[model samples]
Target: MTSFLDEFAQAPNLKYLNHAAVSPWPKRAALAASRFAEQNVLLGARDYPEWMGVEQRLRERLMRLLNAPSTDDIALVKNTSEALSFVAFGLDWQAGDQVIISDEEFPSNRVVWEALQPRGVEVIQVNLKGMDPESALLAACGPRTRLLSISSVQYVSGLRLDIERLGEGLRQRDVLFCVDAIQQLGALPFDAIAAQCDFAMADGHKWLLGPEGLGVFYCRAELREQLKLQEYGWHMLEHMGDYSRIEWQPARSARRFECGSPNMLGTMALEASLSLLEEVGMATVGKLIEERVLWLQEGLERLPGIQLHSPMNPARRAGIITFSLEGHDNQVVFDRLKAEQVVCVQRGGGIRLSPHFYTAPKVIEETLAVLHGLAG
Candidate 1:
């Protein structure tokens, strides 16, 4: 029997610790894409109904992954930005309405709300550097605060917030909550319903172990029709298959967000990738990821002049661990690591290393050894 680790066949000398940015697909995902390409060449859409079944399975998997209410809440989006745009532009905003976000958000999360400035909607940036980041965010909400959009885990610092707590607080305040869950969804166990997020989105290329250009968007069932439709096509219509119908409405489900054709190629790869995650179970996956992150943290802490940037508390961490050498430029350190085939990135004034659940012990050991040499 082959081990689950065997699913990943990375190069012998390549130490890939960049799952936070992009993940190499599992063998199953590759094979699924290959089979899809072969089928396309052999018979052009002859089995398109079977392809649609694969897409449905993908939605079901994503629904389970997010702990969403139902598959009705899941939307297959092009990327995280598109989903964010749907919320940003779809909302009914008024002058003086404000959206609260952290200062450390990725561009997708920040820029979307800022674009609403033209409509007199204010974007408030709260600093998450304080001891109680959740408290800071909650306090920032006032009468004018319309929504609170946050990342489940900070991308650069790997600071995992207590989203359940925030969710409860937002509910009491009657404020809508949106979470950019790209950094946490696959790396940890994410519960959309428990978190009480009105909206959430994440890309498949990162910790999901799939290709880019495809992602999951979850909208609360109650708010399905509340969001105004910004895009329209045959796929998003209520009478989707009835092309002869003169009048139609947007889908009653979250499928309303999906306009035009689905990315069948991406659907094939992501569904197969998600199957591996399901087989492993997210609880086990999250536990193993934590173990790897903690192991990396311990090794980095032992290095001379190492400065840790990610959260030290285990409860406040996800899969990311970032650090910097005391006297080395971040870019220089990143360049050195890149040249050594120790794949990683520089972020938050430090080097960011993200290891997934199946990262080999050898990869971790050798990466530490290389860092030890650099420290010396």
Candidate 2:
């Protein structure tokens, strides 16, 4: 087993702090992908059964990561958007039915619900700037609100919401809870069951440390059959491999959402990436991420002309920290950082810095140094 620190062997000069956008694969993930490619080149599909085993392990990992009730609740989807679509289009909606979301949501979380406009479904955007965002969201939920779909953490502001609170609130009101957990799933500990979330989805590319094309969708066991399936194929059938079956039904699990063939290459990479997270344990992974974000936050505050855009309270944030130098244009500052090999991004009208658990202290120190120079 490789030491966790050695798993991320990024280039010496590259100070990467953009885990919110996309993540560099850990060494093990790359090696797994490479081995899968080599196997295809040598053996074709002769070892396909073993590949299915890898896929099963991936599902089990995702199940445990989300603290879901069972692997039966997990579905491998193309991405977060695809999974959100499943929820958006699957549910029975009436005209004037409402779906509540935060004003700070990434477009994926907002647009899918908004697309239901044609169905006469009203989408409410609640302001999360208040001291208690959860309270604001609950206050916005009226008798007409059918569901509350929100990101577990705001993409640009890095505002982490109390999902459990929202879950409890929604439960009393009988409103469905859907979480766009892309920014929170792998960076922090998540519990689908504890949160009582009806549906949740996340991509593997960011904090999950995997490829782009694969993601996980978790549907509560009771809600599985309630969602109308939009896509169909042999693979999603209850008797999937029995091609001779004249009649069939969708699988009695969350696998019903998967339309066709799976992304085996992505499966191998993500399974391997998740192995690292499991090895380190989410409690430690989340602790390390928060510590790094706080480190960056404190360091940014000490720099001259710095104005922070992300939440200052550690409880209100995750791994993201967005700030700006008063004297510097965001693009100009971004370019300077890019030239200096300080990889970050401009978002929410400021520069966004996102670090993973494995990010070294020097990376944060050096990034702050670059910002300090820009501040001057």
TM-score of each: 0.99, 0.99
* Residue 114, model 1, lDDT: 99
What does each candidate score in C-alpha RMSD? 0.9, 1.0
Q: Please give the CA lDDT of all the candidate structures.
A: 0.94, 0.94
User: Model 1, 1-376: lDDT tens per residue?
Assistant: 1478999999879999999999999999999999999999999899999999999999999999999989999999999999999999999999999999999999999999999999999999999999999999999999999999999999999999999999999999999999999999888999998899999999999999999999999999988788999998999998899999999988999999998999999999999999999999999999999999999999999998999999999899999999999988888888888888999988888999999999988889989988888888
Q: For model 2, how does the per-residue alpha-carbon lDDT over 1-376 read when each residue is reduced to its tens digit?
A: 2389899989988999999999999999999999999999999999999999999999999999999999999999999999999999999999999999999988999899999999999999999888889999999999999999999999999999999999999999999999999999899999998899999999999999999999999999999999999999988999889999999999999988987999999999999999999999999999999999999988888888888999988889888999988878999999999999998888989999999999998998998888787777
Report the poorest 10 consecutive residues by lDDT, candidate 2: 1-10
List where candidate 2 sits over 4 angstroms from the true fold: none
